[model samples]
Target: MKAFPQQPTYTGFNEPSRVEADVCDLEVEGELPLDLNGTYYRVGPDPQYAPRLGSDIYFNGDGMVSMFRFKNGRVDLKSRYVRTDKFKLEQEAGHALFGAYRNPWSDDPAVQGKNRGTANTNIVFHNGQLLALKEDSPPVAMDPDTLETIGNWDFNGKLSSQTFTAHPKIDPQTGEMVCFGYSATGVDTPDIAYYVVGPTGEIVHEVWIKSPYNCMIHDFGVTRDFVIFPIVPVVSSAERAKAGRPTFGWDGTKDIYLGVMPRRGTARDVRWFRAPNQFASHVMNAFNEGSKVHIDMPRAESNMFPFFPDISGKPFDRERAAARVTRWTLDFNSKGDTFEARQMTSLVGDFPRIDDRYAMESYRHGYLCVSDLTKPYDALRGGSITGMFINCLGHIDLATGKHEEYFVGPTSTLQEPVFIPKSATAAEGEGYLAVLANRHEELRSDLLILDAQRLADGPIATVHLPVRLRQGLHGNWVPATAA
Candidate 1:
């Protein structure tokens, strides 16, 4: 029984120590309009959801929605409702916790604040219940239609301090849900691994990820009998802080390995596969093909660690480069195992799927957009075309390896694309794509829509938001038809 950290000392999730000055007011505007007709809805941070430290409170501040809006030629926001639940902030037994540490962005050494509460993953729907993964808390399940919390599973009791990234994968057949969590002592670590919450929300399955290397299971999904995950065998800041580990580069190489662990088998029975090129990156989504699997990613040239230091206003010396789309596939036959992959698309960035219309079933086919945003503050630091690019909303034909860039963007910082499917549309077969763009210089967020198929032509309508949204992590599209 590993002990867990108290609530007040945690910093990740929706709870930032303090709100940045720029996101305070929702008055910022973008280069484009905030409305699209075919898309049903676009929901993200506004006055309701932005991080709060003072007397302010969030309105529609919680929950997640579809990353893309529609299948139509002209995109617009499709109206749909989303719900999120606040995390539990209790200090577990026998753990040391503190509040008010030095602010990441402030120069004041005495500055302090409450530990940030967990910002849950874009909630997922399974067996008539909506489930979400929170950073510092447990897995919670809610109603997709009503957004009412229906269940929760605590990981704090299982490990000392744990955090979750990306959405948990759901087993479509068994009705069981799966998610990965990392636990450490303080901010740094000698961490343990655990899997929390089955799809039904009653079981807290403790997962043991075996590796000679340090295992950090980030984003993953589940198939009939195996839990597919991309593991980064590396140490974290907490581990470094405790072990006195110094920062260095490719000086020590970390391999990004894919492991297929049996759902009911022990860790020793897990079969592992390693991707050839080690890119400092995150696994967006994996397309499962029975024995074979395909992975989609935003080709990162360098380690993702360097990008973290500059998050607190520090300068990160990085090549302002764009990531390409690459696919890795593995086929496990009765005789043996085989691996094959290729560069799917170039000039593209972060991808999210709206529906099953794309060539590959994973994020690669969802919404493939292009941007020059290699680093977080690259645009804020006066780089020309920093906040620029075009967003193409449509399905990529994996067979042809060609992306029909429909909704090409001249927009700023487009976000994960969500599909609203034609079922949510009044025009029969016409569907929409909903996207978020930070057009204004001061972190103003806007909702943009496009015809899912006719995206290259441009958006039909757009909705400019009067609030700000968090810039990292992933979200999803929850259909209005869902209850």
Candidate 2:
């Protein structure tokens, strides 16, 4: 047996595991609402082999898709690995043949020009197909029921962009999906491709454009009339990686750029707005009013990934660079001004979400995965890295700026909460929030259901797990009818 290398990436929740399970009629702490009939799908990175380079990042791992099916007041669980080309290649080799994250030059000679993505970041369900996404490569379609890999999807050969974004937005009313790809052709390339998928899975639109610079454009926003792309300071360079430096880093000299392109037009009509340097990973929602587009999100002062340092090698202070819910208004009618931004609250958090129905329209409530102020987040590797565990779920009111939170305690960690309305006619924020919570004391995890409108009151129902699975990332509640 090959001895596995011991590294910080393999400790705690990041540790690799090979566990697939199926259980039925799980025990519940309270009542599992009968109306909450759907599947909760989540994706996480779980490396199958000890890294070939002996040092690996959390983002570099094979994807595991887990689902909880709810029906008639009962819940069933199932999980499977997303068998990507890289995963299958390593599986046959009986070890890791690839190298550093997405940099191909670091790979073993035997696996030259092999697939680079693990497809582990996020999952989306549309047109009855469950697709696993990683930004560097095209989406891999998976069997939603058995969670089996079908193959990569390129919109039946219509997608020209080699890369695809994980954060695609689905319009609630039209059922259309708005997606884009940065570095669309190759590593560190400055090209971007904006794509649209229709209600029936047709490739309705696509436009190729050049970004201000090659940067990590992770998440974007979509309103009724436009698509919003924020090109921030965090950037990647294959040339720098060939010299054994960090693949991605912050360069303070680069100005943050936001490209507002019309939903029906090409790059020629795109309006570019310049803003002060900042980093934003996610956006809650956006809407188009008369002459301006309003976008709500969490913005950070500097790069949040401690693993990737700034080019100047300046030390980072997390407390000083805290991320908060903010609003950025882009006004086209202003005589001389193009944009304005302001922090909405003092509370700090990330992974903001809203009710899907109000995604591109005016919405009142939003939720976030915030650090529990009482416990205080712990840093590892001599205060060089952070966010091994997060502790609370926060709810904010965009109209009044008042908010509340539900803490899971010091030992437990909470993933991003998925919001679903109580019913079709339910008022805004009148719904349930599904949370995947892990308790460190018993090493067990649970599915917590809380009233979205009254988050501080705590979970109304808790589904005790049959096994203690490690923490996972972004999930969604798919109604039975939709699935």
Pick the TM-score winner. Answer: 2
Model 1 TM-score on a 0 to 1 scale:
0.63
lDDT of 2 by residue, 157-215 (tens): 98898799989998888999999998998889999999889988989998999988878
Q: After superposition, how far is residue 346 of candidate 1 from its true place, in Å?
A: 1.8
What CA RMSD would you report for each candidate?
Answer: 9.4, 2.4
**Residue-level lDDT tens digits of model 1 in 27-127:** 22333222222223223322222222222222113333323332223222222222222322212212112121111222112322333323334555555
Error at 118, model 2, angstroms: 1.0
Model 2: lDDT equals 0.83
Q: How many backbone clashes does candidate 1 have?
A: 70
Q: Estimate each model's TM-score.
A: 0.63, 0.95
* Model 1 score (lDDT): 0.44
Q: Quote the lDDT for 364 in model 1.
A: 30
